[model samples]
Target chain A: MPKNILSVENLNGGYEVFVGRRRVFVHAVDDVTFSLHNNEVLGVAGESGCGKSTLAKMIYGAIIPPLLVKGGSISITTKGGEVLNINKLSIDEVRRKIWWIEISYIPQNSMNVLNPLKRIKDQFIDVFRYHGIKMDKTETVEHLRDTLTTLGLPPEVINAYPHQLSGGMRQRVVIALSLVFNPRIILADEPTTAVDVVTQRTILSLLKEWRENNKSSLVLISHDMSVHAYMDDRIAIMYAGNVVELGSSLDIFKEPLHPYTRALIESLIRKGDKSIRKGLAGQPPDLINPPPGCRFHPRCPYVMNICRSEEPVTTFLDNDRYVRCWLYTSSR
Target chain B: MENENMLKIESVTKLYGYGILGLKKFKALDSVSMNVNLERPKIAVLAGETGSGKTTLLRIIMGIVKPEIGRVLYRGYDIHKLKGSTARWYRKEVQPIFQDPYEAFNPLRRVDSYFYDTVTNICGIKDKDEIMYRIDESLRFVGLSLDRVSGKYPHEFSGGELQRISIARALLTTPRILLADEPVSMLDATLRVGILNILKDLKEKLNMIIIYVTHDLSTAYYVGDDISVMYRGTLVEHGPISKVYQEPRHPYTSALLNSVLEPDPSLRDKYPAVKPSSLELKEFLIAGCRYANRCPYAKEICWTTLPPYIDVDGVNVRCWKHLDYKL
Candidate 1:
């Protein structure tokens, strides 16, 4: 079996939104458990507000105000064979040790993450300096130029401002910044959602090349299934803060076990297939007041009496696949 | 000459940033022309990436922006020259569905007010019962009803539902042409197909022409009857959807088609190589082919002069390579 790099168990997190004078707790991610293996790509896909991004933030140890992790623990095994619980670490410790060196995060919008006032080269220098790397200006510039050229970016972009480059080019520069530290794992949230098709293709290819070359793990979060189909080795389908199905990408696409997964795949508009595809009926449950029992039962087509009263336990299937549905349970 | 087509755009050119004193101008739409026949309603897709002038073309058609070189004709009447009542009639015939549903309406006000306003002002319905009837009927066409969103604000509806409401409001005018600018790009994947289906149904049932502007090729292939591929600020290829998707002649068109990531794992390794443009702004100012900088099949002549439109297999291709090929 492949060695697990990160293990999350019974993770529960939510946002506290204020409704007039009262405070309402929205359980965005609930009881989610998954393990990320070394040197593999794991894709997390679902509709918006399904808690995929919240789960990513929790895993990356980004627990800000109004967004709190209520339960469960996340443990990461470093290359030095030391196990560290992320939630137990202090904010200073996470910033100093865990962030940008052990694990990195790429946000949905590249412009938001990059400092508009700084040049591209200065940004790289700041990251290196923050990590206490002792390098002269010449050495840093040489290193950055080499890295940018290797990633197929022009060397002259180092001198340009953020607004000077196009949206796609700026996104590529953000990707380059994330990989400069050579972190063990990368958590990217919708990296290619805003770019064009051609730019998306290039970015996906560059990510694949980076992963293979460095032998690093990736936790890619996207709502587009086609992106997952192209980049992921293992796929996790999330619905209402729960992992509905987990399996190999090939098996999940060919014979999806969960009804939600099947509906999502069927709704995709493919090339050369002109048959009218229908979207799922109803909207995702409100996180503040989710329905009882299974969260997906209301929207699921294969709802049963048991599905409405009790949540189905995770069932292990053949070929290392897993599903959470009453239809797959032997007791049904 | 009197044009019999429903909409005719001739030599429309729009330039931005006239240098310091109108010196350094950037060409947004270069001498573009197209015709939309209303004999039978069809969906014409303006497909391109960002900054490809697709949105500008839609804006030009809607009369929101005026072109410096050419004019848009509606039923043989120049849209820019139309007077008070004539312009009002033109606005009733051509309505737009914006890209972001969240910004399409005022959040403080009720969503149904837009529906009622459209019926009263654009459709000229006076009676309250008639306005309500028209609003409800138009909502039904897009698989939504007035009751579902009767007194709700824009925040009450999800992105998909809000977009559906926007479409319903557009239908309130009973437009002959619907100008949709990336209507489904903001929607989720599951919701996109449903919205596209509603647009297709509207074209057939209401006998209306739809001009959909988007950067996505999958939805365009699904809903578009005729596809026009745009690069930089020019239409590189325009033809039947089947022919364009099956046998793309322009290098940019072929690249766009090949770049689409199909929802299948078996084809993961089959992606084509895409070379990122180093000088994006320079390419826009190129006098020859704007795509020559990134196109792999570009030649010396392609960088010197613009290519003429060549008819090949019933498709109009603007590439120099097609000049040597026999059609």
Candidate 2:
């Protein structure tokens, strides 16, 4: 197996997302631990307000004020076998070494990254120049042409402005820009949320192609489970800032250990299954002062007394699969 | 076309000229008709991607947009024909819940003001106490109380809470039918079900016919009784939710079903990467079928002539291949 390219241990972050004098802060992410293997796609599946985006920001070192990384560390293993601690590094160090070169973050809104005035090819050159890569204009053009062609994007789009391109084309351009530096890991948060189903599929397939060709690990975060099903190798289910279930994509879908995961899986519409998909009753708990024990106990169908009193420990259910639920606490 | 139904959309066709400079016109809705039964009030999901005229259909039903040719009847009254007080009554009968809860209410105004305005103006509740009582009951029905949301701004509450409040405001009017346009698309998945379940409960408890317009088929399959697949403003298929979902006779319907990426890991290989075709305005106004370009089952006749609506096993499917084909 390839070496673990990314390692996140006990990562925690909170944000004062809303306006309040009560000093209300959403404990968006708390004590989350996961690792990304080389060429592996880790799908982070959760509802909105679950801190998946916040966690993505923390990973990419994109934390802007009001959102602070209180504790924990992110360690990334470089190609040279040198491990870099992302959290301990200064903003300058992160910018010079991490962002765009070794790691790239694809935000939910693809338009945000592209300058409306600049041509798509100019943006590509800007990314390359920022990384201090020394390739001539002709070489750069050739590289971009090959990249876009491989990704199924028409090469002629490089001359088009951000607005001239469709939403799907803009999204593809952003992904192509992220790949300009050949980063080791790509952090994509809801990249396919706003696009059409066909566009979403194209973008997903392109991402899959990128992972295979470059041997890069992908940390994809999306609320749509179906999007995760399309590209994810392993799935991590989150609720109220807690990673309740982690397992192979097949295992999580076929045999979900956590109540939240089970409900989420059951809620999705399957082709053959015409039975009414029952949505979970009640809302996700407020992250400000989430329930004392398990944050999901309020909405969990198989809630036990202990689930209310104490948080369950992560159990090693099977190979590489971890679940935090009372039902899986004991063996079968 | 009037069938004791809550809403009757008969051969509704909404056409859009490609502005002054453009040469062609776009057919956003192509003689698409549907009968929504009020007696069995349930969610009738009008599933389609963007530019499918789902929003246009909702606007036409709400009397915001007039169909070039066709009629939208609510309770035996042609919505377009009604004028002044009669149209006002029709508006009160059919209410709308927009997708964005944050934008639905005025940011400067308190969320409760909408509730009061809806109660007093639509329901005609004159007394202050009576309006308060009505608002309180509506709020309670959506699992929200007046105390928690009475004097709050849109930003003060979470997306889920604000959405619930939006539902409460819509409920205060006590409309017979609620047209929700992608109500849960903006919400988080965990919070989405809350809003979806609320709609489900409201359907049973209040017996309200819901014309839910959305692109997400999963939630549509979850709560919808009847399903109607719209493609660039054309109705491809419509029938019982189970039959349409199970058999899916229309090629567009089949493509949509196959495109849905499930969270399930085992079914990874089931989905084939397919992109939505970029449709031009002129393509929509084509002589025959709008989907003929992308449809693999398209025949020579499909390209030039419109396919007649054939009822196969009780499900209405508008496809040349399904004309002789039965499930």
Candidate 3:
């Protein structure tokens, strides 16, 4: 069995936005638990409002204003066999030790995060400098060049501004920025979403190579099911701030247990497919006032009485397959 | 040929900085020519990558941008040179649904007001009863209603709902050709199918020709009757959607179809690794074939001059590789 890299327990968090004067908590991620293991890509798949992005932000400890970390314990196993709950640590401590060194986050629109005015080389250097680690300038340049070349990008991009490069190039540069430290864990939130199909393939393959070489666990969040199928080793389906299903990639895709998972898989239309595929006949739930009991019950075709009134417990099937559905339960 | 009710884009070429000063120059859209028969309704997908000139072509079709070389003829009339009444008629004949629904609407104004304004202004409907009726009919076509969007602002609705409202607004004019510019790209994958279904319905039920613009081939295959594949501001290949998807004539088209990751995990074929270049800006500025830099079967002629559209099994392919075979 592979060793656990990070374990999240009962994680609950949301954004608190003001509604005319009263503050309301939009439950983005709630009561989610999962363990990410060594050197596996765990895909988080769901619709736009399903809180997968929130889960990524929460896991990164990016607790900015309006986004409140209500409760959760994120425990990480350090290299020296030390178990530390980084969530409880100060922002400064996490920034100094946890970020870039241990974990890296690649956002969807990385161009927004990167300084538009600064050259790409300066951005790469700023991350190293932020950790207060003094390295020789030539060595840092060499390291940056190596990372870029490894990702199939030319090293001359270091001299160009963010706006000068195209969308796909910028996405690769962002991934390169995150890989500077060769972090043991990477959280990539739709890194290839905005790029074209050709570029998407290149970016994802490069990402796979990076993961393989570094032996790192990657958490990829994408709304497209095909992307998850192409990249993920394990899959987790989130709906209305809760993970409705989790399992190995082979088992999950071979036989999707959850009704929502089934619908999502069925909804995809391939290039040569002639049959008519129906979109799910409902909207993604509003997290602010989500449906009670099972969040997916409203849309679930096989909904039961128990599914409406009582929240279904996570049933652990053989081979670590997890499902949250009344139909899967023995009692039902 | 002149009497047929069809859209004739006669060798349209649009270039940036053509008559401008001190601006970096490139062709926004190359010589793109195609015919859309308006006798019957169908969904024609303008499919391509980002910066592939799909949006620029749509903008040119809508008269938002003028072609530097050729003209767009709709129903045997030059669209760009129409007179007052003909232009007003042209306005009523063509309508566009932009990519971003949130940007299409004014956040400060109520959503229904725009519907009313479209019906009143462009549609030229004066009576309040007639305006409401037209708005309700169009809204119902998109699985929405006047009541649902009566008092809602742009921010009050979901992306899907706002997109539906925008579609409803476009339908109020009863456009013969509905231009959708990447309508589903901003939408979630699950919800985008619903919008695609709406486009299909428009073709089937209302008998409207929809020029559906998108980068996703799957959804394009799902909705399109015909597909025009573009690469880097040039139309690379075009044919019936199913045929083009099955056996892509152009190399770029084949590469595009190859790259789409199928949802079934068991069918995860090893995707071909493409080495990306640092400077893709040269693609736009290249005089010959724009995809010549990446195309596998490029010859000497491909670099010096652009190839004419060669007919291959009813598909028009813009590649020098097919020239010898076609001849």
Candidate 4:
């Protein structure tokens, strides 16, 4: 078997917030087990509040107060062949040793990620400074310029403030900042959702090119199925914080096993197809008090009686595909 | 000429500027003209990349922004110059459904209050029973009901549900024309289709014309009967959806179509790859064709003079390449 760079075994994460006076726990990421192989793009797709972002945050080991790591651990095999369980490490240790060195996260919105007041140069230097990595001023400038140029951004972007650039350009600067250390795995959460189609294509293509050149693994998270279709080698379909379906992009699109996955693909409005597609009936489950048994059973079209009582375990299928649905697996 | 139940835009132009004395001006919309008054209601998609001024054109059509030149005529009354009753009539006749459904309403207030506000004011209904009936009728058209949304705030519903509510509110007036601006762009794929289907049902059942403005061609193609491809504040191509999708006459239209990543695995890599062009704002300032700088087939004349609209097989294409070309 190929050495998987990042292996997440039964990862569970969620948030704790008070609704009124009572503290309610929001189950966001629940028992999500998937591995990221080297040089592959793994896409996680779900609707808003499905906890795909929370899952990415957990994987990046960015868990904070209120956002508790309820259970499970994330294992990573660094370039130096050191195996580390990220949950065991302290936040400071993870920050200095892992962040931007082993893994980097590109958030959904660059406007929120970037510092509006500082120049792009200062932002890049700040990251290295926080990590206690000293570099010559000219050398750092030259390296930053090289990365910007390679990503099809002008070198002058380093001197410009975040407000000076457009949304797309600012996103690229964030990406450039992320790539400064050449992390082995990059977790991008809805990177292209904020930009226009042309700019989105440019960012995706550039990221793909960069990944190919560096042989890095990418966990591309987006709600847009079209983006996943073009970028992902494999996909994990999340519904109500559970990995309902996992398979190759081709198999996922062509032969989706889970009913939710089927609905997702069916609901897509493709070019040259004029059929009256529709949204799934009912709202996405409330995570604070998700439905018993299968989280999707409330909205599931082919939901059986068993699906309403007992949750189905992951059923491994041919071609490394797996699905958590009563239709695919027998209930215990 | 009395063109009743018709919507016509005649050479509309809008400009925006920021410089010394506001001298450095750029055309937000440049003489863009389109019309839809089909005997049977149909959706006409205004599609383009961002900064293409498709939204600007929609705003003009909605009468939210007045164009510097040209006129928007709805049933022969100039949209911007309607009198008191005529303005209210125009408002009832033409309604706009905005993007960001959450922003469509006041988040702190009950979602149905906006419904009552519209039905009472613009729709001119005051009786609580009559208001509920009108709101319920519109809501049911979008697969929702008044009771479900009556006591609910904006945050209580999902993005899809709120969007449907907004669409229902637009339907409250029973408007002849619906100007939907990126109705489904904010929703997830599963929810987006439902909204599109609702729009489709409206045109067929309610006999209402919808001008669907979207950057996404896939959704546009799904709901659109007529398609007008815009590029940098100008309408480059306008024709039937089938004709335009199959044979895009304008270079920008072709590029826009090619750029759309169709959600089919089999048809992957079937179309030519579209290179992402930088300098997005510069296109609006181009004196000639707005798409000339990025057009692969851009000729010398494409750089100097704006290409006039040339008719080709029932499709109006703005490109010099189609000039004097036979079918």
- Report how far off residue B311 is in candidate 4 (Å): 0.1
lDDT tens digits, residue span A210-321, model 3:
8998899999999988888888889999988999999988888788989998888777887677578787887888888888889998888999888888889988886557
In order of DockQ, best first, we have 1, 3, 4, 2
In model 2, which regions exceed 4 Å deviation? A16-25, A134-142, A266-282, A297-319, A324-332, B1-6, B17-24, B37-40, B273-276, B279-282, B322-327
Using lDDT as the measure, the top candidate is: 1
Per-model root-mean-square deviation over C-alphas? 1.8, 3.4, 1.9, 2.1
Per-model chain B TM-scores are: 0.96, 0.94, 0.94, 0.95
lDDT of 3 at A110: 69
Per DockQ, the best of the predicted structures is: 1
User: Candidate 3, residues B1-327: lDDT per residue as tens digits?
Assistant: 754698999889987763236376677888889899888899999988888888889988998788899999988888889888889999999999988899999899999999878888787889989888889998998898888889889988889889988998988889999999889888876788889889888999889999999888888888889999988888989899888877888888888888888887777666665646336567887788888888778777777788888889998888888876233
**Highest TM-score among the candidates is held by which one?**
1
DockQ of 3: 0.70
- Superposed by TM-score, candidate 1 places the C-alpha of residue A270 at a distance from the truth, in angstroms, of 1.0
Candidate 3: residue pairs that collide: none
What is the per-residue lDDT of model 1 for residues B1-21, given as tens digits with 9 covering 90 to 100?
A: 447656899989998764447
lDDT of 2 by residue, B270-300 (tens): 6675754653454576788788888887777
Candidate 4 lDDT at B104 equals 83
